[model samples]
Target: MAPVSHAADRVQSLDVYLNACKIGTIVRTPGDFNAFSLDPAYRATGGTPVLSLSLRAATGGLRRDPRPLAGALPAFFANLLPEEKLREAMEKHHAASVRPGNDFDLLAALGADLPGAVRVVPTEGARAVASAQAPQPPRLRFSLAGVQMKLSVMKNTGKGGGLTLPLEDGQGQYIAKFPSLTFPGVAENEYANLALAAALGMDVPARELVDKADFEGIPEEFDTLSDGKVLLVKRFDRGQGGRRRHIEDFAQVFGLYPSRKYDGAAYHDIAAALTMAVSPAAALDFVRRLALCAVTGNGDMHLKNWSLIYPEGDGPPALSPIYDMLSTVPYLPADGMALTLGGERSFKALTPSRWKAFANRARLPEPAVLAAVAATAARVNAEWWHLPERAAIPAAVLARIDRHITLMLPILAECGAG
Candidate 1:
């Protein structure tokens, strides 16, 4: 790694690697936008160990071109970094060196530990451009794309089982999501929601709500949030011995920028993609998760939330495990879903007819889709009340979820889910 350059005119370029093999180069154009081109050797190998679904052409070949990256990194790369408050926090923490909203520089700073197997490093003579003269702090050199303040921490194998920042060259095994000032009890809410999701037979990652003090390296401000607890979820893309599997979110698949995660695509689009690229069973799993979201009032399942994991790092894609499943209605009672379902966005609008309509549009069998919805609804109604995790939720929030499920039962019952 070269010393951070301060020259305004110096070209900024990064080598993109997957599984430690260089695949392409992303260059910050003279116009300040980014452009990427495949490395000749990697291109000759026929795009093995797939990088992203978005990078594939409609003919099922890699799309090879270079153009202005539109004031940010391409959607796939852009979605790899944190957003909103988390991004602001990182920028503020490294204010003296990294610029605010500069995706290229952010990637150079934290690329070694991005989600999946992809890693970015500055190309020789093309280094990250820093601004101020103040000495910078140690880089928080891992990126997890989301607005929430979370850290990619490694679990200690000692008796107490604490979590801390990954040691040099070590990978984070769990994602520790901290309590948020804006959303109280989110950690507990998510624990209850994930418990319900797992009981409903959705494939969810292993998770637990642990004391915040058990986690080290969390910044002071986030450490002092709503409660003394944080949600720790095992990383699905990582395997034993820290082997990396590749993954890309639906936003990357559809080539939509992260800001447009709620637009330019719908739930039907995702189902259709699953049916086409993955298996019919994968599509059915998606339907079940969608039903879970509706039953739990999880309004934040945007394109970025749904992802495809390459099981073998070079293998075909499958739906990743359920994550970020908090009941948002307790926070914003009027909020709708992050993406539309059958042209409707309201959770109250979920009906059997809508499921049928969605099945028709998504090219899935209507009966299978309806069966998934019924199964998910039945499981939620049956299992949620008995889950011990529900006791951890705040009383008011629990009551809100109770009311939400009660209101949802009628529509689900019409599908014979009750």
Candidate 2:
């Protein structure tokens, strides 16, 4: 009974830690702005409101204790680096020790790397760059190039806390992410994968890893040698100069329609959400790309991981920047695409028969769909090996990845042209 009781308490503590890891704005003081709280369903654990972030700028060091949520969360993230590497990174880049005490000084420290979209004004009305506007709490704040941003907590929502801030300088907005302690390598992995995708000519958000000590919203403990780092990417949705509308996830745009569930309506709604007329041709193209992703070993393609972005002015919405792109299947044994194809769970479902069936159901020309599949396969075969090598992945792992890619090419070729 005593052991059980202890375990229960431990779980509760992890929950609190996980909840605190989410991304949100830090108000200088509580009640400075309206309190916006998400419902319980938004969290990984469906108990209390996992995230209670304030939207307004707050003062102090911008800190929150994670001890409370330590139990419900895992001690480490799935498929990250070994524990030792994480420990070394945390020690080398302790955020607390490097941060300035005030926002103005922090902004001065961040000099030129700041994005052009955000502008940081002085508390007394003097316009500073972004770092000067950081909300001070128990967290450490710093500037990068002059943009004001924080790394306070990871939002409980699985959306990964990527945002496009409006800065005054250039049109480029920032994309921020707060990873959990459980996933120590998430920041580095995301950075690496983003680079990989870009090199492959896939559209991805411009991204980089900010030193934890340089951001005011991140807590000192989180930036400590023992704590993990967060990953931040630059947003592309912003207009030429920072004047852009807010971005929306597919679920929000599609209403109650479930993306993981394949149906005629699902296909139609997806095309409509992109503001493109539904057609068998487009569906085949979309599915072929997705199948290519699977062949390349990306198994984390859930609905929320994809989005449709509307840029400034009138134009049909296109696929949002490719994100959350990873070879999850190779790293995490349990990882797989969230949606099934032809009643099969793995990428193997991209069989000729299944592809034909899906194409027929979507009212697409089977030949076009098959051609798309062949193109994707050819692209994978031609470029896959060169990528891992240039990325400096270990030779052994690269070999395994090549084998997997090779295995999928035959199946993709088998999909007959309509």
Instruction: Report, for all candidates in order, the number of backbone clashes.
Output: 0, 68
lDDT tens digits by residue: candidate 2, 286-402:
665576566767765654455555434434445667766655544564444555554455676668776666556555666766677677777666666666423543344445556
Best by TM-score: 1
Per-residue accuracy of model 1 over 1-418 as CA lDDT, tens digit each: 4346423245477889998788998887776878888998878777787887777777866887657776688778989999988888767655554688888777776778899889887787775545565434455678899999898899888887778887435689889888877878889999999988888777899999998878777766335466646899999988899888888999988988889988979999999999888988899899989988888788999999999988674467899888889889999998777898888878889888888888999999888888888877888889999999999998998999888888887776566543
Cα displacement (angstroms), candidate 2, residue 40, comes to 30
| Model 2, CA-based lDDT | 0.41
Q: Candidate 2: worst 10 consecutive residues by lDDT?
A: 73-82
TM accuracy, model 2: 0.51
TM-scores, all candidates, are: 0.92, 0.51
Per-model lDDT: 0.82, 0.41
